[model samples]
Target: MKGPCTPCTTPAALTRIGCLCAMSCALACVCAPLRAQTSTFNGAVALSSQLVDRGLAITPATPILQAAASWTSASGWSAGVSGALQTRDPGHLSEGLAQVSRAWSLSSAWQMQADLLYYDYPGNERARLFDRTEAGIDWIYRDVLTVGLSATSMTHGADHQPRGAADVDFHWPLAGHFSLALGAGVAQYLVSPYDSYGYVHRPPPGVYGYGHAGLFWSHGAWRIELDRIATDPAVTRHGGNLVAQPWVGTVSWSF
Candidate 1:
């Protein structure tokens, strides 16, 4: 009869609609965690000291304060803004910086990351505005070791010439949520007449080489870092300033 046929088709239609709804709900549940894991916010502060020696005179030690806020995504995307103030007795300079990075997972034991940074330096005597751009890559091996390489270019407001630099770093993890990093690099100032107190008139084709070592520890909500930096052939040419070096200690809380 026509009546029987109508009833039979209605039940089958209802069943199909219910199945589609269930499948949609299942997919949403599976994706919710991945979306939630991708975004994070963090803040930190640090203090550092630097010893500068010019071939002619050695100036008093310098202290620097740095603060930053960053956001990172679970899929390896990150962005951050930072500011720094450096003071030596009565003289000081301030800088603002921004950076972005992306990370790719290559395998269970290996990963790669790339980043770019921009900086603005104010109160510079030689150039009121200086622009610096950098690109770098990091490789992770065995969840304990990482190596990185980076290149940077710096431009002054007045000069057409741009400075170039290269950097390399190695990092290893230690016990108690601690890690150690070592770095070495070279930077060349292309313009000889550039006049920042940090890079005042001295030599054409100015070259500086540096080494850095640091330790980082994390416990509960607290993170701490201790770092040392040393440069050869002193960037400046004052007496008793044969070596230019800086040491840093930082502490931060994670939310």
Candidate 2:
């Protein structure tokens, strides 16, 4: 479900700024109660030091503004959209995502969810090569631990073969709204041709691993988190820039 795709930088300072303002206003809505059998809507806005997805860094040493909103029905189905834009000069989009999922409870201590996710990289010519749909399922234990597995086919490319991935994550609560988060995952990719920025050099198709350890604290509608991410050294040695970032921090408000 992962591939080597370079982030794009477009000239649209005004556009990006407008998006930031709009999202900020939208997310300022009052927090609503989320009760069983009741539909709910939620929105959040955040500032992060880097844009990382699936343990891969999407932006190089740049801060970003992100916003997301989701709606969930009483039937355990949900849909959401999220976007991130660079915070510096000539700000442009980093990435956008759309997701739909369904959840079910199997027992008092266990639950499962199936998800379909789509990734979009606007203004990047190679976007078509990496943008694709990922289908996966996750199993959760007591809302603390999760195990996920997914696969996707690189349909835009000539080969049209499937890539598979799996990940494990743990979120343990400490005290007073503080928690420790840990995750590790590996992804498969097809070698991509070189580009002007040399973002990706032709390499063999294979699997690479990435992981993160972080701490989180929440109060009311606000949450803050800090994480240190690391990827297989081979990711860089193979001309993939997913290893350039070491630390990521974020402050978010959700309602």
lDDT of each: 0.43, 0.57
Clash counts for the predictions, in order: 12, 0
Give the per-residue lDDT digits (tens) of candidate 2, residues 129-244: 56667777777676567777878766465666778888777768899999776777787753342431356646534777777777878777777777777777766666455444
lDDT of 1: 0.43
Q: Kindly provide the TM-score of model 2 when superposed on the true structure, using C-alpha atoms.
A: 0.80
Q: What is the TM-score (0 to 1) of candidate 1?
A: 0.63
Query: What's the distance in Å from true for residue 28, model 1?
Result: 27
Tens-place lDDT per residue, model 1, 1-255, is 000000001111101110111111111121222354657665555444432111111123345554556666666666666555555533444555566766666776766666676655564332233456656565655434445555556654544454555555454769989977565656554323334343443443466665556686766556566656555544434212233335544454433
Q: Model 1: runs farther than 4 Å from truth?
A: 1-36, 50-62, 86-93, 123-130, 142-144, 158-164, 175-178, 190-194, 198-206, 234-243
Candidate 1, residue 121: how far the Cα is off, in Å = 1.5
Give TM-scores for every candidate, taking all chains together and pairing residue i with residue i. 0.63, 0.80
